[model samples]
Target chain A: MTRPPPRILLVEDTPTQAEVAKALLRDMGLEIRHAETAGRALADALANPPDAILLDLELPDFGGFELMQKLRAEGVEAAIIVVTANASVNTAVEAMRQGAMDFIVKPYAKARLTVTLNNALEKRALTQELKTVKAQLSRDRFFGFIGASAAMQAVYRTIEGVAASRASVFITGESGTGKELAAEAVHKASPRAAKPFVALNCGAIPRDLLESEVFGHVKGAFTGATDNRVGAAKQADGGTLFLDEIGEMPLEMQVKLLRFVQTGSFQPVGASRPEKVDVRFVCATNRDPLAEVEAGRFREDLYYRLYVVPVELPPLRERGTDSVLIARALLATLSREEGKHFRGFSPEAERAIMAYAWPGNVRQLQNVVRNVVVLHDAEVVEPAMLPPMLLRAAIRPTAPHLTPMAAPVVAPVVAAAPVVAAPAMAEPAVAEPVPVQALPVPLPEPIFVPVPPSPPALALPPLPPPLPSVPVIEPLAVMEKRLILAALAETSQDVARAAALLEINPSTVYRKLQAWKTAGEIP
Target chain B: MHALRLQPLGLCHRLGVWVEPKVDRLASRWHHCHVTVLDPSIAGQLAEDLPRADFLLIINTFRDDLARLTQELTAAAATGDHHSFHRAAHSLAGAAAAVGALRLEASARLGMADEASTAPPPPGLSARIATEAQAALAALAALAQGPG
Candidate 1:
C-alpha cells in the first residue's frame, strides 16, 4: 500500500549543475534520472514518465521553452520546474507561461531547491486529485446525458462496467432516449478515448449505399462514386464504431456486417482484398430486437454477436423527476442560445412538465424548451408558455371509478333470463324479464303479448339461445391513421417532427397526407 | 591534481593545460602569476552549503568546462570568428558565476561586449581569460581539498 518515491527527471547540459541538482533531489528521498540534452530528456520522459522534471534552459539541442511545449503537447502530466543560470524576469515569465510550475536560478541553496520541488509535487498531486473528483462528478451528467434518476444511474453503471471490455455493447431505448450519448460515454470512458469514435445511423442511409458507407469504397465503385472514401469502420480503428438504429439495417447488409463483426475485416466496395481494423463495436436500436429476430428482420447470429452486453435506457416518463430536471436544464441552455433572459420555470410549469408523459423523451423536451425560448421572453416560464399538447395531456383526467349500477349488467340478465322457464313466462305477467340480445335486433313493430296465469303441462323448450355477440375490432389501417393524426396534432402539424416522434420517415408521412387529401379523407 | 584529472572531459582537456601546442605553451606560461581567483564570499557560501561529495563533483566538472571553453575562446579569437567568440564568452560567464568565480565571469562579460566591435578582439584578451580561468581553477581545487 505504500507509494513509491517521486521520480524526477533532471535535464541539464552542464554536468556540474546536473550533479548538484541530483544530490539535492536525492537528499529529499526522491529518485533521479539525468539527461544531458533536451532530445534525450524528451525520449526518456516519454518512455517512462516521471513525477516531476527539473529543466535547465540552456540545453545543447534546443531551448528549454521549446522542450516544455513539446512535453505538454505529448500529454506529459509531470510538473516542471525550470532551473536556469539566467535570472532574467522575462525568462521566468516565459517559463511559467510554458507551464513550468516553478523557476529557480542556478547555484540555489539546498533549502530553496527542496521547498520548490516539494511545492511542485504537492501541486501536481492536488491537480490529479481534482481530476478524479471531476470524473466522479461526471456521473450525474455523463458525456451529454443529464440525469440522476435510479434508472439513469443503473445505465451509467452498466456503461462504466462494460467500457473497459472489448465486448460489443447493445443499447436499447425508446427514440430520443440518448442512445448515441450512451455509446459516446462508453467510448470516452474506455482506454480508446484518445482515438476516434465514429457513429453511423443505419436507418438513415439508403439500403443500396449502406454497405459502401460502412466499409468504404474505391473510386468508380458505383455509378456516382467519383473518388475513394474512408468509412466509419476504418475511421474508428483502435476506437469505437457506433451503429445506430441497427434494427433498421437491411437483412442482406446484416449478413455482411456479421462477417465483419466476427472477423474484424471487410472488403470495401469493388476491392479485391479485405482491409482489417482494430475496432470496438457499440450498436443501438429503439426497436424490440428480439421481436426483430423472431420476425426474421434481424439476423439471429448477428444479434447474438452484437448483443453481448445490453444497456436499456428508461423512457422519460419512467425516470421520475428527471423530466423536470432535464426541462430546467434545457430551459437554461435554450435561453442562453436564444439570447433570452428567462430565469426558470414557474412551479405550475414544472408540475405540468412532470405530469405529461414525454413520449418523445429528451428530444421533445428540448424542442419544447427551445420553442418557448424563441417565442416568449419572460422572467419565468408560466404554464401558458408550455406547448398546447403538453398542457392538454397534463390536465387530462384518469379513468373513472365504476359503481355497481354503472357496471355491466348484460351477463347477469342473460344468465337469469333462461332460469325463468317458458311456463312461467306464459302467465299473464307484465314484469317478465327480457333477453338482452333482443336490444340490437330490428323489430317490425312494438308488440307485447300477455301470458295466461295457468301454466301448461307441456313446457316449451327454453327460448332458443340468444345469438352470441362478437367483439368489435378496429382495422389496422384505421388504427395507423389514428396514430399518425394524433402524432401530427401533438407536434402542431409539423410533419417532420411528428414523423420523428412516431419513429417513421417524414416522406412517408407526407405521402400518406397526400393520399388522404386526394381521397377526400383529409382537407 | 587527481580531482582535476577525474573530470568527464578526459585528460586532453585538463585544467591549466591544452592539447593544441600553441595554447598549451601560452597557458603554461600564464599559470605563474598570482591574481584574485574567486570571490571568497560567493565561493565560501557555496562550499558551506553543499554536501562534501557534491561539492567535489561540481569542482571537477567546473575544471573540465573551464579548460574546454578557454580553448574554444582562444581558437575563435585566433580566427576572428566574432560570433563564436561571443557565444563562448556568454557560456563561460554563466559557468563562472555558477561556481562563484566573479572575476573570470566579469572578464568573460567584457569579451561578450567587445563582440560588437568591427575590429578583432583587443590584444591579450584570450591570455587574460586564460590566466583568470587558471587562477579560478586553482582556487576551486584548493577549496575542494580544504576541510569539509
Candidate 2:
C-alpha cells in the first residue's frame, strides 16, 4: 500500500501569506493543513497530528510558541519547523532550543523551506527507525555501563579490543559521556584485571598540586605536605592509571607526562631519583586535543604521544533511544537506593527523555533520574516528577498514543485571552503543563466552588483564576511579588495557608507582610 | 475621540529621513533586466548540486520573501520601528544578493548601512524600498516561471 504524502500543518495568521505559502508547498506534493489561529491550530494538531508542522510564532489568538508548548506537553512527536517574519537571531535560537527541529526566517527561499521540511521529516523517519532498532536491540547492559544503541555497542567492542593490548589507550568525549567508565571497562577486560584500576581527574586538582596528586609527594615536598603521600601513578603501579580531563594538565606537567609515557618511569615530587612502575596508561579528555595543540594550550608532542590509540565516546544525544535503555537502568538503581518502587518511566516520561538533547550527557541523565527518584514517588516515573529543566525539554512532536484519562482537554475558556487557558482540573496535566505548578501556591479551598453532584465520570475539578501558560521572563523581585500575591489569593488571604503554599516558614511571610505594609506596596 | 492611537508613535525619527527618488526611477525604466534575476553562476552551481524541483523551490522562496519583506518595510515604517526596518533591510539585502537581484540588493545594502537617524524612516523611503522589492519580485517570478 502506498503511504499518503506527509501531512504538514502550516499555522499562519495572514490569509494571503498562508495562501502563498500553501501554493508554494503544494508543488512539493505535501498535503498542507492551514490553521490561522492558535486555538484552531491546537485543536487541529490534537485531532489529527501531522507528520510535520510549519509554525508561525506570532499567531492571532496567542503566540504559536504557546501552542507548540501545549502540543509538546501533550507529548506530540511531530517534527516542527518554526517560520517567523519576526526573524532575529534570538527568536531563531529560542525556537530551536525549545524543540523546533528547524527554523526558517521570512522571505526564505522556497528551496530553504523545502530543505528544512525534508530534513525534519528525514529526522523524524530516522527517530522512528531508531525506535524499531531499540526494540530489537539486546545486551542493553554491558560491564558497568548501560546502553543498547549501536554507538554503545561499538564502544563495548572498542573496550574489548583494546583491553588485551598493552598499548596506551586514549578516550575522548564530551563531559558525562562516561569516559571514566570506558577506561574502567578497558582495565577490567585487560590482562591486568586483577590489579587495582586507579583513576584521577587531572582538571579537578589545583595547578600547584597536580604534580604531587599524579606522581606522589615526598615527606617534605611543600609546606602543606604533612606526610609522604602515594599519588595516582604509584597507586596504580602494575595496574591501569586513568588520567581524566588530561587536557587541563599544565604545560609543564605535560613535559613530565610525555617523558612518563615515553618511558615507564617518573620521579615523585621532591624525590631524589626516578622511579619506574609498570603502569598501563589510559588518558581521557573532554576537549579537542588537536585544537588544543593548535591553540598552543597543549604541547604538540604530548598530544601525539597520547593520541596513540584513540577511542571516542559519543554524546548521549547521538545515542538514539539508548537514553531510554540507560534511563530504565538508572531508574532501577536509583529507585533501589531511595527505597522507592518505580517499575519504570511512564511512556510519556520515556518519550520526553528520548527527545531531550541531553547536552550534559549521561551525567546529567543520572542526576535527573536520581533527583526524580529521591523527591517523588509513584508506581511509574512520570514527566511531572522530573526537574524543571527536563520539563522545559518538551519539544520533538511525538504521538501521545496512550488515551490517558487524566490529560486535561485543552479547552479555551475566554475569547479575549486565549493564551491563558489551562486545565480545569485539580491534578496537574502531564507534560508538566506549565511552571504554574512550580510556584508556591496552595490549591483553592473547596468552598470557593460549590459543586452539585453530576455523573461521577463527567465531573471536572473547578478551575482557578486563569494564568498565562506561556513561560514568563521577569526579574527576581517581580517574580517574588507575584508569587506572594498569587499565594495570598489562592489561600483567601489566610496567612498560614499562604505560608504553607509558599513552602516557607510562617514567620517569613509575616516579615514580608510587615515589609510590604511599610513600603505601602500592599494595602 | 480625536485619537492619539491613530497617530504614529514617535516623531524625532520622522524629522530627518530621506527618500531616494532613484528607486522609482529604477522601477519605471525596467524592461528585460540587463542581468538575470539570479546570478547565472550561482544558479549554474545550484542546478548542478540541487534537484530541479529543489531549484524551483528556491526561486519560489526568493519571490515570496521579496513580497513579505516589502510588506514588512511598510509596516515598520508606519509604526516608526526603525530597528525592525533595519533588520528587514539587512535580511532583504542578504536574500536579494543570494538570488542575484543586483539593483534590489544594492539599495537594500544602503538600507542595512542606514543609521536610522530618523526614527522609523523618512517619508517615501518605505515606498522606494517597496518599489525595489517589487521589481525584484517580478524578476524572480519571471525567473521561476521561465523554462527550466
**Model 1, runs deviating above 4 Å:** A1-139, A392-523, B1-148
Residue B1 lDDT (model 1):
38
DockQ of predictions, in order shown: 0.23, 0.02
Best by lDDT: 1
- Interface C-alpha root-mean-square deviation, candidates in order: 2.2, 7.9
Residue range A1-523, candidate 2, lDDT tens digits: 4878988899876543465466557668888898978898888989988889989886646887788899898878899889875567899888987899989876455578788899999898899789865654555776788887888888887788789888888899988999999999989999999998999998999999999988898888889888988888888888999999988999999999899888989999989988898989999998988999999999998888777789999988778788888999889988888899988987768867876678788898999999888888887988767653343233212322212223322222111212222365565454432322122222221112122343322111112344433334455466566666776776577666566444456677788779988999999
Enumerate clash totals for all models, in the order shown: 2, 13
TM-score of chain B of 2: 0.62
lDDT of each: 0.75, 0.70
Distance from true location, Cα of A509 in model 1, Å? 25
**CAPRI accuracy category, model 2:** incorrect
Q: What is the lDDT of residue A483 in candidate 1?
A: 60
